[model samples]
Target chain A: MSLNPLHEIHTRRFSRNLGLGLTLGAFIAIIFGLTIVKVSRGDYEPPRAPTATEATQ
Target chain B: MSDVSINSPEFTGQGFEGEAQFGDFFALLKPRVMTLVVFTAAVGLLAAPVPVHPFVAFCAILFIAVGGGASGALNMWWDADIDAVMKRTARRPIPAGKVTGDEALAFGLTLSAFSVVFLGLASNWFAAGLLAFTIFFYVVIYTMWLKRWTPQNIVIGGAAGAFPPMIGWAVATGGISVESVLMFCLTFMWTPPHFWALALFIRKDYDHAGVPMLTVTHGRRSARNHILVYTLLLAVLAIATAFTSVGGPVYLVVALVLNALFVKGAYDIWRRDEDVSETDNFSVEKKFFKLSLLYLFAHFGAILIEAVLTRMGMGGWT
Candidate 1:
């Protein structure tokens, strides 16, 4: 069979695909996981009050 | 196939030559796709419960748009050969010789690097990281790997296009949520039906280009069946989104009416014979294709309206 460069690149090993899938799955999981953790730990603090310097000005 | 040197720029006179025009640069961005990315990302941003500063939100959207454009440029650079052979893509900047492949590659790489770095600095690292992955997915994974080889290209490649809203949501909240995941799912599920409708009508183009699109590889009848199935799936997902925190009565009403029309249009396309389908002036396929665009825009628009109303304390399921 003649080696087509483009086809070679296209049909390269499945290892890369597996790796990428796992990485994306992990990335999404971590982000959502962090959000859940943050929300659940929340003692809902409002935005900080302006400094005294701003009040004097 | 013979190996060609990549050091020298490939220039064909059939496309643009001499100097690149303003429009040539703009065309490299794939503006039509960019519009959808921007709109969906904006919806994601607005729909988030956290209120981002207006200026920060604008900047985030701008960078997201740039990241999307960068991905398009790189994709065009890599796919120029097949693009030159395809009728639908032959007039693109690189293929047309308005811009050299190397020039497109360089432009794309520079923009990709800049967009990711700046987006990271401007927003949280999480958003920046997602933006980088999105660019990598489009260029290295979808455009480079799956597109020419598999008939499932669009199905797998849809994830790259679906990331923008999630990235937008991350920009606001510095993280992802079930809401953001649902938004991502909305775009991901909609893509197969939208593109397959065009594939049905343009199977000749794919055949000529030697790209293994579903319509070309599986035949038109099977492709039509797949489109109908995906459209049905998309209709269900779209209506379900209306019950989430970001959705409300207005969105539910819109989703019900639009989905009914969309499903009916898909059914019309599914039932027609290809020969008879081609002969009609207002073909069901063409109508379905056009309606698919509106279907997505309406869903996103309803989300935006719901978000705005909820912010004003006058809407949402409280």
Candidate 2:
């Protein structure tokens, strides 16, 4: 049995694929990080739970 | 199997298409210029009076860099033909046939929208808006409009590059201020002299490309004079910045020394004629170009130091 040599095109294609994968991965991580920070900082805090007096009113 | 033998006709037809590596695509972003953007923008954010969440700040700078890179990709798309002509730019992704203009355009536009929207969500709409405007100004106003039309292109186009620090400041403060404006002015003023020095040496490239650089349009003598004038103005602005909140003792000293060297460099260029320049192969102009890089970095580095000192309670005059 014999194996074919790696073509230059394969190298280019592989690099492109790997780069795109990494970029997308990094982008997701950035979004996740940003979400965590924003949430912790109260930037996206939900409305306060209604108090008994407010609910009665 | 010899791939060349397997599909010779199709291979010849495809040419460089489908052959681009990730690095080729990344080259479309003009990473060298992006580095300057990243550095200055980080300096601006750190130097602000308000503190930023470290992670938020990191994301902000990253988005800002992506925005800057997107603009650079758009520039490569628009300037592909001119880029093909100039020796300096002939090897760029689009010009070098490593990437297609349409692919670059799509890449640039996608990143532009993504970066702007995310920057707004991550920081504030104000900084995002400034980033959008910077992309527009660089791509539309500078690249497509002013670049091919006027000799003063570099002067005005310089403004596009000058906005990163201001955007960084806006990220922290959610608004503009005197300090931010000073940072903006520092880069804006520094651009003309920096580029003019380069143009003095590489005037042939601009001439061949018909870019109408000051050196090509006004003659080298006039270009030299302009460099001196702009350097003087930049020196004054840089020195005055030391007295601002963004500056302090360290910045003042850095500014004084760098500006003096810069002004002297400019003067040397101005006093020399083409004969003298040719005899020494434009050494003075080249040195000025090198110094200009160091000058901006040192000034901003000093500002960053001042910011650190202020944080430690030992920095500002007050």
Candidate 3:
């Protein structure tokens, strides 16, 4: 039988714990960065004012 | 000589040990939680100042729901061990043996990757990024770390659950706004009280599972105090949200009434002793638990109604 020591170690050390942490951290950073860039574009164009169709009873 | 031994037939199954029903796959997605996510995301999309194409809006919400479901599957896979020990959770698909842990892990990872990639392709990167973060936060930060480590788990972990509405808003506008943050804050503040009330009643289950819920680690009295404190904060946040772009006369009325009832319920739970609670005819804990669910749904429902009214130009911020 062939044994895969590296696979076992990778699963124990990386796949189970630290990998999730690192991935989550990176994901949050990306969101924050994208939000900052979007906000900084100086494009504050709010949608057109509510129309009469919107105001109808 | 007349005695005959009975032989049992050997069982051969294609996959895992237990049978995986169609329902099991659905359960893995945590349908109840997915419903809440979908509703909130819909409200966010509708309430946004910017207009999105109807078809695009629908696609965004679909992706958000898929992301939420993927997070749930990952959560179940990771918490299978603890779930097996808790009576309330023991019957969940993974812990109940209807699905193998490896199968669940693979399912979750595949969905997570697919949902993020597809959402990014379908919507703007901003919304996709939020969805991805939400999934990661729920699976990695909340489920794996905070849940088992501290009584403050729900307080911080609540952020993950609160992101759906913000993501929805981003879908429409391609950006974040103060209004969306307030919506997120509403759910974030509400979570501690909601979950702590359940903890008060299920301390034994958490204790047996060694999960370190506030009630188990800090004592029931402390948990009750925490619940009241967070509930008060939640009431303040909920009512204050009424003044934002999303708020109006209708939502204000709903928020005021709901907050009053919610605060009273929290106070009642805080005042009762465990011994008294056991002997009392009315289980305050149980009442509080049921009310908490209603409280969240009512708040979100009110938000949706306000959005509809605003869209119809009948009421809302001009």
Predicted model with the maximum DockQ: 2
lDDT of each residue in B266-318, candidate 2, tens digit only: 99999999999999999999999999999989999999999999999999787
* Ranked candidates, highest lDDT first: 2, 1, 3
lDDT (Cα atoms) of all candidates against the true structure: 0.83, 0.92, 0.82
Q: Candidate 3 lDDT, tens digit per residue, B31-88? A: 9999989988998888888887665677678779888998999999999999999999
**What DockQ class does candidate 3 belong to?**
incorrect
Error of 1 at B120 (Å): 0.9
Go through the candidates in order and give each one's DockQ: 0.02, 0.51, 0.02
TM-score of each: 0.80, 0.94, 0.80
Which has the greatest lDDT?
A: 2
> Poorest 10 consecutive residues of model 3 chain B by lDDT?
B2-11
Candidate 3 wrong stretches, greater than 4 Å: A1-57, B1-17
Q: At residue B190, give the lDDT of candidate 2.
A: 96
lDDT of 1 at B169: 93
Interface RMSD (Cα, Å) for model 1 = 13.9
lDDT of 1 by residue, B1-318 (tens): 343422124422312133565567668889999999899999999999998766567767877998999999999999999999889999998877778888888978988887787677666889999999999999988999999889999998999999998999999999999889988988898888888888877767888888889988888888889888988898888888888998899999999999999888878878887888778843677778898889889988999999999989977888
TM-score of chain A of each: 0.53, 0.71, 0.52
